[model samples]
Target: MQPSHPGMTPYPGQPFYGWYPPGGYGLDPSDALVTPPGAGLGGWFARCVGAARRGWRPLLPILVLTQALPAAVLSVLVLAVDPSARWDAQLASDSAALPANFWSDLATLLVVVLGGSLLLGVVQAVGWAAGTWVIARQAVGESAGLGAALRYGARRALGLWGWTLLITLIVTFGFCLCFLPGVYAAFALALAGPVYLFERHDPLSRSHRMLRDRLGLLLGRVALVGAAVIGFSLAASVLESLAILPFGTTPLDSPGTAVGAVLTIAVVAVLTLPAYLAQLVGLVVTYAEQRAHEGPVNAAQLAAELG
Candidate 1:
């Protein structure tokens, strides 16, 4: 029995999005940016790995600036808020009862911490969103100008921001509810980005749709990405340790002190830059995949050139 249309075709050389043709000068809007067939869990992970390998170069600087700047700002804010208080039983009990000077210091600390936190949060959001756009552009092998990057981010910033806030609240509230289901919910919601980008919907809407349509795949992929992230983070931690000279005391050795301040700072610099750079590459490829095979970024639709 021959069916009119083959429902289960193999992933061919031409991508479903048709962004690029085989040996073509540029991608055709009409052509499908097809995935290679048999791309299951292993294949998907390989795609992530491959994307990271290819797009590491342009992604490094942007990632470093985006991640490091906000992190540094937050650290400064924390230090400013609580300058040096040893955690003895007595001190812990009487932090508020210490002295007039203590009250004055506390007030100053609150101002710095709160103000810095707010500022850093906004910048971090913008920076991360922009970094995502840059990675997406690179994934598609498209020209990524600052103007275009900003526009891409700006278009989706409000939705992304709302999504971030919503997820943060979910995780925060989850932490209060005995912690297990909250973790699952947080992981389950992680696919909102791919959904957001491809579906071109608000994060909340995307989250809902993904939950309904493909929760299993979404959760599975999130776990995969999380595992990969953790593995790389562990490797970075090891490298950070190695970066210190052979003879050096670790910061953790000292209680309530910046014991390995130098090492900590160095590690943040070394690990953050490269890790994000690689991640950005993976993001680009995934974006392309979703734009093609997945929902909204449809090749057939875009081919009509409505815009």
Candidate 2:
């Protein structure tokens, strides 16, 4: 027999991961988002694939606008303001001294990269929130539209962006200290976005709690997601780098070069869409599973909470 109460966790090792329904897997067979802790990797995978299939209509446009386009603009900006031309000059001059404007160029490069990161963070905030809304809706077989999802994103973007910036700072500080610490910080804070959206308070601490409670499982799931997204990103970067080699250090010098640069970036930007989809679906669904491990929840409850 199951625990007398749905919330009771009999095993000390299991913590908040209580009993599922009689089906021996999830809370309900009819729902994709209710996969409890005992449902295993298969359950989580099914839910992720289901969320993607159900939510793609809204997800595609949301990702393209917030994720892809901003990325394209940032790429263009970085290439346009590249400081590498000075390096070429320095090499050609065969001088032991640095370029006269080397420091200035380096400053400009840092500004563009940092500034572009901040702007891209804004769009990514919107995309993450909107994508969550769609995933929650479609997980329960309910319709989620692009307009409504985007509107919801607009409402939550500021708060999410703020949290993201804080996480970024923490990660940066950890990196300053050491590489391992930075990676640990990233894994720990990975769930903050979904936690903020679904619970709205102390997301950083709560996400850390989830990671602490189920370290191995959460690490495996999150690492898999990271691998997929990072792999796709590396591939895109390589393609974009190769595509721009013909244009030289300063691609914006001529109209033809500028057009080639933009087009190559545009292609690479489109290629980023899969990374976006995998990231959104994988993390959100994984977060749901973490919630299931914590306490009683279902697709309907999550959908209601998302609002």
Candidate 3:
């Protein structure tokens, strides 16, 4: 049985509405009189699963392209410039005075690669913010066009980009200030996105707020999703490892070894699609929970759109 509304007149056989967070708080966790945290968690998990099922296909290609292009281009440039062991070996043998031109060219190439990577990082951070905003709009039931969503996100891109750079610097400085705390600080800062996404709060402020909130629930959901990701990643690693097992004595030290490597990569790419989808699902669910429990966001739109 379902209740028509919260705490008004109960439907026949319907439980009371005390299970919900409160009046004006979003969705009810369940029909129970006293809903436990586990019930809230379960609802969130289900919401994540449902949202992922709907949005994955439309969103994934964009996500991949956004992340991949700059990374691939930057990596290629880096590899092109970086001196390989073979080159170093050849140079070592011919230590009969290397040409000044070689040294200058190598130095120039290294600088170009490094500069390209830095530039790519700035651009990619913007792209990631845009991607997240697209996911956010979809969660909110806006029939937002990718172009429009990206444009909206672009308005905040500099803020997102600057925040990321600032965090990177903080993590680096923290590491220098104290190696152990720095490592912990890096992981602790991961909650900044949920803050930005759910509370519409700034990343730095979210970090502090989440610290106060004990991050247990958020991290719990993230861990569940991360487990799924790791499982897929491990499967891929296993396949790659097995490829080596087939040629027991033969070392994977040549172009021939690429046959198995390529196959493994292909399989991994195909399978990891679901894991990536799950990540988006987890992200949306986190936001949905906020909309439900916190009255700031219009949960009515989510129920209609995501329903």
Q: TM-scores for all candidates?
A: 0.65, 0.89, 0.63
Give candidates' CA RMSD values in order: 7.9, 5.0, 8.2
Candidate that beats the other on TM-score, 1 or 2, i.e. the better one:
2
- List clashing residue pairs in candidate 2: none
Q: Please, what are the lDDT tens digits per residue for candidate 1 over residues 1-307?
A: 1211112232233233332334322223322221232344555566566545544554455455556656655653454345344323436777666544666777777887767755555555555566565544444455556655555556665666566667778877887886886876676566565445444555555455555555665566556556666777778667655644343333333443353554455455556665555444344344444333333242322222211
Best by TM-score: 2
Residue 75 in model 1: shift from native, Å?
1.3
> In candidate 2, what are the lDDT values of residues 1-307, reduced to their tens digit?
2332232332222122233556333355445776666668898889888888888888999999999999899888887778788687886787787877888888998999998999889889999999999998887668888998999998999899999999999999999999999999999999999999987888899889889999999998899899999999999989999999999888888999999989999989999899999999998988888876665566777777777
The candidate, 1 or 2, that scores higher on lDDT is: 2
Clashes of each: 14, 0, 1
Worst 10 residues of 3 by lDDT: 1-10
The predicted structure with the larger lDDT, 1 or 3, is 3
- Candidate 3 C-alpha lDDT tens digits along 1-307: 2223222232234333333433433234441111223456766666665555545654565555444445545543553444554455667778685644577768867787767866765665555555555555554455645565456555655655666667788888999999987755655665565445434446675565444465666567657777887787677557656654653323334556545544444454555556555655565555445333323223333323221
Evaluation by TM-score, superior candidate among 1 and 3: 1
- Window of ten residues with lowest summed lDDT in model 1: 1-10
Clashes of 1: 14
lDDT of 2 at 194: 94
